[model samples]
Target: MLTINCPWCGPRDETEFGFGGEAHRTRPADPSALSDAEWAEFLFMRTNPKGLHRERWVHSHGCRRWFNVERHTVTNEITRVYQMGSASEAAETAPAAEQAPATAAIEKQGSRS
Candidate 1:
């Protein structure tokens, strides 16, 4: 019974959204260079934290936009959500990426329209 607050569709049941693995996970620049052990670690290893965690999530049943989410696993509370752009956009907006959290971005984007 998890209620996910979609940036576009308001809060909805968790069933409507799909879970993405750990966020901010950058792929190796040269995949072919990595050994089997390294590749396996990248594919299977993850930080299953007890508190706040940043992860990617998609609104499957609503807007269908992929966004970053900060969730608390213990209480199932959503702390923040923001549109996680592609690599180029992320690199270009590094300053904004540092200045505000996802919640602020969501609000600002909402107000502009």
Candidate 2:
């Protein structure tokens, strides 16, 4: 099982959390202006990239707070964890050397598997 580091509650078993889907999606400025296809795309479309992916997650069994996670899809390695609304585009594109300490810990865990 994976150990997820909750920004509010520290590291916890993955079972304590709930997946909240892809993050950083902006709501349309005027929903009424959207055609049916556009509205459906907004609601259902998500990127299924093979490498790094940003996602939302909630600590359901602990603090019940929401956070964002940057994870590697194929390896299941969580590279970063940040509170909701605090992530910046620059941080998202930062180099590995500048990655958070939590990322190192998660990488270590991934290596064990």
Candidate 3:
């Protein structure tokens, strides 16, 4: 079974999470200014890269919070995991799973208030 590290919930079985599609897909600021083709492209176009892919995921059975995941498609190896608004570049280089001060521990500490 593949282990996915959730930003808030820590490492867990893949079954506990929900796979959301590609990440960083920003919505157009001026929707009314876009042509039909441009709108359609934004709505439907997605890169089906065979190598490393960045995506969104939700810890459905755990924290129930959404986060980002960088995974290799062919090997199904998760390279990194981070929260939605975290530094994507940093997460891509160093996965939260391997970081010393994990966000899950921080979150746990915060909840004691």
Tens digits of per-residue lDDT for model 1, 1-113: 87777755667789999999888777888989999999988888899999988888898987787777888989878877756765566556556545543334353222222
Higher-TM-score candidate of 1 and 2: 2
lDDT for 34 (candidate 1)? 100
What residue pairs are clashing in model 1? none
The lDDT of each candidate is 0.72, 0.74, 0.74
Query: How large an RMSD does model 2 have?
Result: 7.7
Q: By lDDT, is 1 or 3 better? A: 3
lDDT for each residue of candidate 2 in 1-113, tens digit (9 for 90 to 100): 77998765578999999999998888999999999999999999989899999888999998787777889999999888765653363344335424544443322112221
lDDT of 2: 0.74
Please give, for residues 25-66, the per-residue lDDT of candidate 3 as tens digits. Answer: 889999899999999999999998999888888989987978
Shift of residue 74 alpha carbon in model 2, Å: 0.1
Name the lDDT value of residue 89 in candidate 1.
Answer: 60
